[model samples]
Target: MPTGSGANQATFAGELSVDGSTVSIRRDTDVASERVSVSLPAVVSVTDQTGEARYPAFKAIMGAKKKPIQTMSLADLGVDAAQVGWSGASSKVVDVSPTPARTAGTIVNDDGTGAAQLADFLAGRGFI
Candidate 1:
């Protein structure tokens, strides 16, 4: 399985691999987490929280030690290195501030009267 986790939170992306007998799920790892590889045997069904049965064959390939995972540089993949990562990311956030609190509005006392008031307000604003 493939998972991403840290000190305060974790999120599972999906399973890394599964064979007929075993399944590998991804999970978030903390700084102290260890990497492990295990073997699993013949296929079966996998169900998620929504009660949907997953077709094993349609699942993605699981990660394994036997197969080497190659890490290639962006230039190696035919992408310009200068246009990747921090250099390529658009829109930098300079600062963030909390929004001002809003004041309370007058409450409608009558349902029938409120409907007409609402319609007039919306109409004046060109919303209706």
Candidate 2:
């Protein structure tokens, strides 16, 4: 399961339904959340807003630790080496460049005209 940004990315990847099933995100000027019931055999991504995590019990944890770890290669999984890893990757990085520096922002000091200046700034930015 994924959440928040992960959920959004999964939606873009077509892995999960757009906006998810259990957790739906509605965005206008800001983001809003809602509960939606979807069919089974579907992917559901959650967000921090959902709830806290429930840690496994000591017995379950001990059992998990006792479980054997199995490692397999692409050949063992019936996958071709050429069909996986960087060699099989569909995309290639042609070049890399540093990000452009950001311009300085207006600083609003708490002067008597600060409120007016802020309003003007907001209006100019279409955020008013």
Candidate 3:
């Protein structure tokens, strides 16, 4: 992961490591790159920095077209129809409202004192 927003929410069910037998996760940091390995039968959620996915070759695509695909319904998976579909949802949304409009911002012109004005604005907003 590239340490982007919400990156800290990434988690795993098993022990995370730099090297292991089955699976591994690679992430980029501010100072260095990291590699985390996990045992077999593990689930990994990666970020966008993992790498560019390679396009499937034409032959592979053709082969995939010839493969048989099995489609199953919830009942086929031993699940009740009313317990998994939208009709069986536990909660309902009664109403929705639009977000409030934002107020106009303070614009500072470059008059040799722009830096000071910006510092003051940030301080007033408790950002500094």
What lDDT does each candidate get?
0.53, 0.59, 0.67
Best by TM-score: 3
TM-score of every candidate: 0.29, 0.48, 0.53
State which candidate has the highest lDDT.
3
Better of 1 and 3 by TM-score: 3
Local distance difference test, candidate 1: 0.53
lDDT of 2: 0.59
Task: Order the candidates by lDDT, highest first.
Answer: 3, 2, 1
Across 1-128, the per-residue lDDT of candidate 1 in tens digits comes to 22232222222423445456444545444553322334443232222422456554423344343567789876677888678778988878899999999998656777678888888878988999
Clashes of each: 21, 0, 2
How much RMSD separates candidate 2 from the native structure?
8.5
Scored against the true structure, residue 19 in model 2 reaches a CA lDDT of 41
- lDDT string, candidate 2, 1-128, tens digits: 53432332212211223443343332222363333444333454444543567999999998999899999987787888898889899999999999999999889678799999999988998998
Model 2, poorest ten-residue lDDT window?
8-17
In Å, residue 113's CA in model 2 sits off its true spot by 1.2
